[model samples]
Target chain A: MDRPIGVMDSGVGGMTVVREITRQLPNERILYFGDISRCPYGEKDLETVRAYTIQVAEYLVAKDIKMLVIACNTATAAALEILRERLEIPVIGVIGPGARSAIQHSRNGKVLVLATSGTVKSNAYPDAIRSLNHNFEVTSQACPAFVPLVEELRYKDDIVTGIVIHQALKSHMHSDADTVILGCTHYPLLKESIRRYFDGRKAVIDSGYETAREVSSLLNYQRILRAPEGEVTHTILINGDSSRFKYILRDWLPELKYDMKEIELKV
Target chain B: MDRPIGVMDSGVGGMTVVREITRQLPNERILYFGDISRCPYGEKDLETVRAYTIQVAEYLVAKDIKMLVIACNTATAAALEILRERLEIPVIGVIGPGARSAIQHSRNGKVLVLATSGTVKSNAYPDAIRSLNHNFEVTSQACPAFVPLVEELRYKDDIVTGIVIHQALKSHMHSDADTVILGCTHYPLLKESIRRYFDGRKAVIDSGYETAREVSSLLNYQRILRAPEGEVTHTILINGDSSRFKYILRDWLPELKYDMKEIELKV
Candidate 1:
């Protein structure tokens, strides 16, 4: 089967996952969809989230993807179960991988989840972590403004960013967590600031990396791993503009060559 | 008579212009398109830029927009003239407005143009500035990595961000320019950092704001300004997902409610 592994996010934030996926499964071609149109699913209602999630999933399925990775935390929280049930292929979400990693890595058994409002409200990470290790204490913080702040590329604005991160991490800082799970894929973009904020106190976990590992394991277990014979290619589809998305891929995956093509997704 | 103004960019960066246009022209509704599919037109070649620009323009024109704002700098440089000639409606680009603003604001008649490699290479701002005032000395710098850095939301990652910005702006810092025009739409997302980088030494001119002003003027000149009677609404269309885009919009334009709708643009 030469079909590609499908990964989707609200925007390029999922590129983090696609980058990891490429690194881990170099032989497997990946199809990544960034719904840059309806991105930052953090603040939308559940119905709207489900609608967009289905739209993207349907579009990717139409592309003949072998598997689907809900690379977005918000979408995973809102529609992962539904997608897994509805789609023919196996469906994976970032929440489980990230939560499991946090659970496995937490020294103090207190793990902090930094994610969008929708993710936190759904208790997706907390539930995933608890299911893996019942004794793990998962504290979730809704960093509603972080995505936009990052999206707007305000990462270097010390004063504004410092204030925002400080506000978002205030509750987490007071908690006894020794490891932080970047629940949302976009959170990795703010890793430096996040690490600095919790500097020396906690280890920051990237969902993208953990999810990639999971994908590798699942593919191997299913005996679906492609032989590293053919040249590995990654096709990135943006239902918006491919210009900025290409640059983002270059920045995040530096080693990978991004072939961004425009695709119109019917909602 | 109640038709909305069509504004398009490679990605969400154009929301800066959309926000301004909304603020300035409160009576007019906006049908905004962020070609999130092929965004960040800065690094792409001319042929690619022209093709993408025309694709977006045709999509917007099909929506029956009264005017078209090529809110993206690279697209403006690559396809503004072609669009103006091809379309029956008045077409405005950020370059002219940005140059006009830079010329008007520069106290010493020495202005700096900061944009993507494609836009800078096109000499769009320089051409526009010279057209307005021949004596104006315009220094242009291609901040290639800036857009990707911003898109990755690494603007707050102090070390990496500082290094990138320093490298991109190093050449311009040594110059005699007093006013720096953020020639690219995406550049505005990095405005705070860019401003902080050149703190107290120069005034940062945002092309989006200037473009909005020009858009207002053109509408007024064309006698197409909608009467301020009905409720003013803004419809945001993203070719990807609306969630993340909404987050950024809420942060950038706090007061406006962003009704995000998914748009499938036929290329």
Candidate 2:
């Protein structure tokens, strides 16, 4: 019952989800993995991305986590089913929750999905949203620059960040989408800019927040929630470099005390 | 994959969940049972409630449902864990989803739970909300009269209905609760009146809608979702008189085509 919940992403982007999980389920311990060695899974083909994701997931599974959360949209679109089929514990992904949130918020039955290129090509958000609600009209935009902006630590409210987001969403500025699903975990780091770029008109749905709520619901329903008195720990593993990761973690979660390590994954 | 989802409630209160399920997952079939013979499980002791819920769940499990949703809050508070342990399929409850929704919606930490006397006596809502996030300040008000208002078909907006709602929530008019949780399934039917009573100030949280969103997420994650091409069916079972149930179904779901039957449970 006190087992750590494993969270993984292509790179430091998944910290958005980890941030949320810490806030929502404070009693639970977290084991985070960021594959900085392969930071951009969004540009790869589905088969390659699936293989890389499985390697990362297998590493976490071997550590005996109680649950696994695929915090990367590209990885979730590629490998969530396989991981769930292979893992004994509950495996949750960010796609379904974001799609559900978009459905919940979109009053006009029109939604805009902002994601990485791989996720857009995979059509996971549109499929997930339309499956739950057929009447919804979905529009997907691939923000290839958005992830780079977050990963390069350029997510500040500056002119360059504004220009990047504006250029990415220039076409849908006047679209009828009442809800915007932040389909990528890293996109939440750029949430303020994206919202401002849209002039705060559309509801920006955070995949990490929705995913954290889903995790809480499933854990409680499964009766596997950690006891309130259990000791909480956070362990972060990065495949490439730990210096930048450490800086980002400290900035995003100033109060979170955790161990950061750099390791070479066999993958 | 075409297996139906089983939903059980104390009585017509569960219809709220069924309505949401139909709207959210149109391809999925529903098998619903109402223990109208013992209509109000809210007043019973915990042991009695548990026994009655298991009896109803076992009946649904025998029908080979792929999933089980405990639509009644009191029954969920009492029997969700036991049923999840005993049943082979996925079991979902309204309490966790409601609690999660309140956590997601409340701008302030203060929240109000509107439920039956048995649910408040069980201390389930407070425990559920606090377990997920300790910062929340929960206030539970047992509106025992609320259920009867819906069950006796006195939910219509009239002088009596207004008086009942006013008296039920009289003490909390000036309270600091920023969110109101409709802990009982039947309470959503009285949503408009409740919101009006609060003068559209507090955010009204519908457990049925939140639970339905969770059901969709779980089904998609488990890969048990019905195919888009699958022919959908709705079946309703009641342990006692069903003429009233049938009328309510028609009124609540005007376009739904369902098979209604009355049968006695051996319990």
Candidate 3:
């Protein structure tokens, strides 16, 4: 009951999921491992992404976490099922929850998924939503440029961010989807621009927020939810220099500031 | 960093504050002691309220909390300053944050505070808001029956709750207070009906939410926030049978399920 929740992602983008989980489950401690050394897992091959994800998951499981949350969409697309099968604890992913939330908010039966190239190509969200409701119209738009811009903290520069969003989403601008699922956790940081671009016509589904809800629900159903208790110091690990990881924590979640530890992944 | 946060309330209404604190600072464990044996501190004399408040405060202080939150408005009105002066850790109250939030949200310089009779009589919010800005119009309405309705779980019954609200605020219907500060934590539970009664014209300032933010800011500024770490189970102690407390927890926050311990207060 006192074990922390384990979460792994490719890079700081998963911090969005971390932030939501913190907000939703404040008493539960988080054991986060951001594989910054091998980030851009979204651009890698299927087997490579799965291998990297498993390595990180194994590290978190070694930490004796009560549950596991795959905070990255790309990793979820590649390795979620296998990780669930291997791990003794409950495993959660962002794609299914985001799809479910978008499905809930969508009025026109039309939904769009904004994700990394890997997730879009993998058809994770499309498959998840379709399996639940085959007739629901789903569009997966890959904005490959979003990850780099967000990582560089260029989301603060509205002009450049707007241009990138416009250029990337130009083809799908005319589509009348009432809901847009932010499949990439990083996209929520650019929600204002995305909302403005659509003139507030579409409801942006932040998969991170939905994923937090799902984790809480899953833990509750399993009767293994952490009881609210003492001061919990979250553990953050990276397989590289902690400098960039530190900057991301301050910028995204100043309230949850903590030093990141360097770890050897033996890659 | 692993010390618990002390929260003292007159009765179950402050569970609303506990709920927000749990949501806002999920990683930090809460040490809550509700005086269910002598609840409705709203009806007590100032000195009596102060004594009871101090007793609970001292108990929590002994529990070695890093900070203290006065979760009840009546108790805050009566004993916040004394408690702060007496305690070594940072101590916070619901009134100031609610007043500040109301001032921030109000456009017409018109604000109404819905509080228990004790708080209204003490003029806690009006004085707090006006002390910051002298020209702002402030009205404190005494919802004498609200606490009981909420405590008895009558708020779940819309008909009685609606009639009680209507009867309580009949005279203020024409008054254009664009911001309604929920001075009593219990008032948040009745927010939907209150909003509907006002036809969504007034923005509800949930003091509990604002108080949670204040606690976070204070802790962050003081550099005393609990680092997110190992599992932490919150300690909840009530000065009487905990059957009602359990029911309220389930009703108000189903996601947060934990056992409440019964304790002797010797009031």
Candidate 4:
């Protein structure tokens, strides 16, 4: 029960959720797996995404992770339920928390979700929201360029990020929805660009923060909350070293120091 | 199409919606009716609330108003559909817009809806939200003391309103929800207090702004948009003069000046 919580995503993007878990539940240790070799899962078919997610999840579970968190929306939409049925530990998905967060703040009961094409094609958010409150109107757009914008740290270069974000969300500029969800885990890195484009006209939400809250809630309700006085440490593993897991995380979360390990994916 | 838009609420609380409309659609003229004598309709039963809303809507229709807006959530919950069916002009409700806004901004997918016991009992927001996206998790709590808190201008005195708001929302302090809906029209007046209590953890959305955006969208879509170049004037009417309509309106929106007329609700 005191084992580290397992968190996995397609790439360094899952760091967003990792950072939140670190902030909200400081006492808990984290075991994060980034399938950096697969990199952008958004472009893959459902089966491929699921396979990659399963591989990463299995790796984390073997490491004796107590809980599983699908930090990437694509993986959640593709593999969460299956992993839940297959794994004994409690499983959490980014989409659910993000969708929940978006629903909670939208004043018009209308929402604009910006994820990847795979997520949009899967109709993940709409389906999830419909199951929770079928009366909400959902609009989703896939931003193919966003993940790169964040990974390259282009978001820090506002002018370029703004252009990409505005172009990605242009059609829904004056959408009936006055709130936008950074549906993809990586989208949180593009938060400034998203906020600047909406310019106070809309509220922007993220799954990282909400998912962290959920992790905290689940931990408490299940009576597995780590002791506050205990020393907490975290581990990051990447399938390949092509991705900048440490550099990006350190930039966004300079407060935490983490040592990352590079591991091989059997497949 | 050039005629004034009709807006009504059980009391001056609906003025929040009116103010939003005035700000968002500056060129459109508004004719608002507040049944001040029947203030605090949150305590009334559904049938009575429905009847009161019908009468008010009818009165506005009789005024040659182009569009009808049920600015009170209770009235909208009780009568929006029926009135929409009965009236030829477009009908709008505060609840739908508020729910939409809340859904759009919530990061946790959990929403805390604060309204009068009557509005909460009517289940208007939940119904409307469910109609759009059933996946939302909604929590509705009625604050019987909120209307008076705003009407008495207690919010201006943070020390007073903060205490009242904190007490009202304390039970849901760590609610799974990361967003709060100002479910009642008057609750917009209590926003700062509500925000302060939640700190920055949750987004506080007001139906007033959402309703205004909806009105604007409806006008454009219905092709009833008034020419911006035309001279626009507004009128406010209350069933009783005992209410402090002028003082509150002027205090909140000094830029808007409109003559008031006294009317009566037969029942």
User: Which of the two candidates, 1 or 4, achieves a greater TM-score against the reference?
Assistant: 4
For model 2, how does the per-residue alpha-carbon lDDT over B46-140 read when each residue is reduced to its tens digit?
Answer: 88889999998999989999999999999999998888788889999999899989987787889999998889999899999898888789999
**CA deviation > 4 Å runs, candidate 4:** B1-267
Question: For model 3, how does the per-residue alpha-carbon lDDT over A139-247 read when each residue is reduced to its tens digit?
Answer: 8888989988887778899899989999988887889989899998888889889988888888988888777766654554345756656676898988888877787
Worst 10 residues of 1 chain A by lDDT: A216-225
Off by over 4 Å in 3: A1-195, A201-267
Tell me the deviation in Å of residue B205 in model 1.
53
Ranking by DockQ: 2, 4, 3, 1
True contacts kept of each: 0.00, 0.58, 0.00, 0.00
Task: Residues B14-108, candidate 1: write the lDDT tens digits.
Answer: 88898777654556789988877676788999789999889888888898899999989999999988887799998888887777556545778
Candidate chain B TM-scores, in order: 0.93, 0.98, 0.97, 0.96
Q: Provide the lowest-lDDT 10-residue window in model 3 chain A.
A: A214-223
Q: Global CA lDDT of candidate 3, please? A: 0.81
Candidate 1 positional error at A59, Å: 1.3
Model 2 over residues A4-121: C-alpha lDDT tens digits? 9999999988989999888878888899999999888998899999999999888998999899999999999999988888989999999999998887767788999999889999
After best superposition, candidate 3 residue A108: deviation in angstroms? 21
Candidates in order have lDDT scores of 0.79, 0.89, 0.81, 0.80
Q: Residue A137 in model 2: shift from native, Å?
A: 3.0
Report the lDDT tens digits of candidate 4 across residue range A93-136. Answer: 88877776665567677888999988999999997765444558
